[model samples]
Target: MDPRPPDETPGPGQQPKPPFDRERFIFKTLAVVIGTQLLIYSLAAGVCGQRALVGRPVGQICPGTLEQLQGGFDSTLKLLLALLGGAALTRMAPPS
Candidate 1:
């Protein structure tokens, strides 16, 4: 004679939530932050390294074009890894 439908289970028992894991959470967050910083640094390295240095007082060239190319490739790899890391972290996060 109660109005509620039989299909609906009463409150708390129906859903069981996982306990918070602070260590795991902190570790994950730290990893994510490191990944983000790496990504930024990589991209910045590509840009900063690519600049043509015309006149250095020293006769020797500090960085040649090959170094710039290497920087670009390294940066691209770091950026790609960061994105992949973020995806993994997102999956690991708790629903709460």
Candidate 2:
């Protein structure tokens, strides 16, 4: 009847490599990373723009001065800090 051998075979130190799903993991991780970066940049840009328009040059009185620009820059830096906070939140996602 059967002359070959048993179907179940086990090699030394080769405990059937616990099935790795690479493609799914890669796509999901990339999506989360890229999305986070984009969100951070968008948030920073929006905040800075709003701060820059706070005051100055009303009714063609005059262009914005250094103080106004400095205020905007300071707000931009704060926005960056907020962005960092947003990115940190992504660490809790899957496949850590």
Candidate 3:
């Protein structure tokens, strides 16, 4: 017969291990990054009168806001594409 209880938990000052592993962490990170970028782009597009569904026909944005939003969108897109391309290249590389 065992002396210890079957449902033992961590002792004081000890931390429990996370439920998710490395793959889950990576997936969550990617999801958050991509989701955030998409949200920002959508909001900016709506604000700048560029989104097809929610945007107004006449321009309602401030003079510099539209340009700034476009520039930010372009930069973010380039960065995301570069990161995805690099990851794909690494994945496709043969083991050395």
TM-score of each: 0.40, 0.37, 0.45
Q: CA lDDT of 94 in candidate 2?
A: 70
List lDDT for all candidates, in order: 0.62, 0.58, 0.68
- Pick the winner on TM-score between candidates 1 and 2: 1
Stretches > 4 Å off in candidate 3:
1-61
Best by TM-score: 3
Question: Quick one: how many clashes does candidate 3 have?
Answer: 0
Decide which is better by lDDT, 1 or 3: 3
Q: Estimate the TM-score for candidate 3.
A: 0.45
Rank order (by TM-score, best first):
3, 1, 2
Model 3, range 67-92, lDDT digits (tens) per residue?
67567667766776786788789889
Supply the global lDDT for candidate 1: 0.62
Error of 2 at 39 (Å): 1.0
Instruction: For candidate 1, give the lDDT of residue 62.
Output: 31
- Score residue 96 of candidate 1 by CA lDDT: 82
Better of 1 and 2 by lDDT: 1
- Segments of candidate 1 deviating more than 4 angstroms: 1-13, 53-96
Going through the candidates in order, what is the number of backbone clashes in each?
Answer: 0, 0, 0
